[model samples]
Target: MGEIAGGIATAGVAVWLIALSACDIRSRRLPNTLTLPGAAVILVVAAGTGHGLAAVAGAAALFGVYLTVHLIAPAALGAGDVKLALGLGALTGVYGADVWVLAALGASLTTGVLALCRRLRGVRSTVPHGPSMCLAAGLVVGLSATV
Candidate 1:
């Protein structure tokens, strides 16, 4: 499981997720300032620790998938969300495919519930999905530890 089993990677991801969530919620933007550098750090650490190829491939694959979705419906997700997915993919990859699927499911459920609640409140505007991503990241990381 790489250093995520050691907890350092998970801790780093936790902090990064919090920052990303806060930025997205406050400004409805996930700045390149955060996601780019964060992705770099994750890649470097993963490579140095011998999970390089898997991490890079996972990030690329997830980024591509999300990018495709963004291309199809640009209004549904911004570039920032795609970038955030890259980082999350790498983090999840270190754990495994099961963890990745679980995290994605968690994110989807969180987002759906949040969206439903906002709709019930008569909010028709976009709901920032960054926090839901963070929630999923935390879930995957914590759950992976136990499993």
Candidate 2:
């Protein structure tokens, strides 16, 4: 039963990430509707699975970091990215701090590379970070599962 529930939760996270990534790529926006509820659902599931502390810590850490970035340079990191971090952090946090750190690094590096590519192409518009975030988290989750 627990395994079944965990699988369902994982699926939910995957779907949520994919949906948000698509939306962000298309409109450069992450809806509060998806971000808020997705975080809540993951947190609740984490608590139920005895990983509440890690999940909360991860969510808070990411939220704080992103929020500070958004505050310092609103043009650099948008509010949507900050909000999206809550759920991604919780998802990786449930696995462990190591996984969370890996996901964070992956997201940061992927975004940086993407931005550099865009700059090289002379497209001066903003690069959507949400897809990078989602991809990193999803990849980390998949890799952690295999390990």
Candidate 3:
């Protein structure tokens, strides 16, 4: 029963990430319509699972970090990515600090790789990092659900 529930949760997160990825890739935007509600849902789930404090802490940590970067380099990181991180952080935080760290690392690495790839192709524009963030958090949650 636990495995079944885990699988369903993983699938749901994956779907949400995929939808966000598509939007970001298309318009370089992570709409509030998705990011805000997604964060609320994950936070509620964390609360129900007895990880409310951890989730809030994770969200704040991630949000603060991203917000700092956005403030320092608005062209390098978008407000949408920071907003997206709130939910992603909570989603990973429900598992533990380790998972949250891994998600953050994964997202950073993914974004770096994408930027490198674009630079190599002579496309100097900034890469929208929302997809990488979504991918990282989804992978973290899905992997945790399996274990």
Candidate 4:
């Protein structure tokens, strides 16, 4: 039963991420409607599972790190990226730190590659980050399964 519930939750998250990616790509903005509720759901589920404090802390930490980066290099990242990280962090907190790290690494690497490809093509680096967020979410799910 737990496994089934987890699978359903994972699938739901994936669908949510895909929608967010589409919106971000089309409009360059992530709607609060998607991110806020998603974070709330993760927090509620994590708390119900006895991982409340850790999950909250992880989410805050993720936000804080991103906030710092945003402050330091505002041009390198966007507000949507920070919000996306918060959602991913909350989900990762439900799994574990390892999954969180894997997700972050996956997102960063994917973004870097895309940026490089765009640069090589002599195109301006205006890559939307939603796809990277989706990749991170997928990586988190895969890593959680391994654990």
Candidate 5:
């Protein structure tokens, strides 16, 4: 029963991520409607699964890190990316710290690749970041299942 519930919650998170990523790609912004409620749902589900406090802490920490980066280099990161990271952190913490680390690594690698591609094409680099987030989320979820 617990496993089944976890599976359902994970599926919901994936769907939510897909939708949020698409919206962010189109608008260059992640609406609060998507991020806030998604984070709330993850928190509630994590609490029910006995991982609430850790998940919340992880989310807060990730948010703080992103916020600091945004403040230091406003042109480098967007507000939507920070909010999305918070949600991803909550999901990862609920699953495990390993998943969180994997997600972060994945996002970083993807961003680097995109920047390189932009440079190769002689285009000004401005990644949407949503696709990378979705990629990271998917990788983390898949790795969590296997591990």
Candidate 6:
């Protein structure tokens, strides 16, 4: 991808991710409104731009990872999250499998630290994972585009 195209793609995906994060933060639910359309947009762009097959593999790979956890503890992980992961996996997958690994590891570290903090504070309420996911997505896309 050229400089302008990569920048534009990253920007578009970032916007989507940020909007979804806001919704998730507010409602603790990732409505299909944003995520479904967002996934379509990412996959379409990725396919048209020559990242098609990798994007599919990426989405499947990440979806499976989350599915495993979801199966283990359905209550702890919501379906919305798994759906969001599918979209995000496709997004990160455009770059490569390594990008998905980076995003997952980075997001996991962020979530773990925040969750630990909340536990220490005696705040038992569930923390929304979407924001961390978005943060990781943004970081991966931005970093990959630059490199």
Q: Of the candidates shown, which would achieve the greatest TM-score relative to the real structure?
A: 2
Per-residue CA lDDT of model 4 for 88-145, tens digit only, reads 7887766778777777677778888998999999999588776786778677776667
lDDT of 6 at 96: 87
List per-prediction Cα lDDT, in the order shown.
Answer: 0.83, 0.91, 0.89, 0.79, 0.81, 0.85
- TM values, all candidates: 0.89, 0.95, 0.92, 0.89, 0.90, 0.92
Model 6, span 1-147: residue lDDT tens: 788986787678878888888988898888988878888888888899888888888888888988898899987777788888888999889888788899988887888888999999999887788788889978997889679
Error of 1 at 127 (Å): 0.9
Error of 1 at 89 (Å): 0.7
Q: Decide which is better by lDDT, 2 or 4.
A: 2
Ranked candidates (TM-score, high to low): 2, 3, 6, 5, 1, 4
**Which runs in model 5 stand beyond 4 Å of their true positions?**
1-4
How would you order the candidates by lDDT, starting with the best? 2, 3, 6, 1, 5, 4
In the predicted model 6, the residue pairs found to clash are none
Tell me the tens digit of each residue's lDDT in model 3 across 6-77: 677667777889999999999999999999899998898888878899999999999999999999999889
Best by lDDT: 2
Task: List per-candidate RMSD values in Å.
Answer: 2.3, 1.1, 1.5, 1.7, 1.6, 1.5
TM accuracy, model 6? 0.92
What digit string (tens of lDDT, one per residue) describes model 2 on residues 16-79? 9999999999999999999999999989988987889999999999999899999999999989
> Which residue pairs in candidate 4 collide?
none
Worst 10 residues of 4 by lDDT: 137-146
Task: lDDT for model 3, please.
Answer: 0.89
lDDT of 2: 0.91
Expressed as tens digits, the lDDT of each residue in 1-147 for candidate 1 is 555466776677788999999999999999999898898888888888798887887788778878998999998888998999888888777677787778777887888898999999999987887788778977876877787
Error of 2 at 33 (Å): 0.6
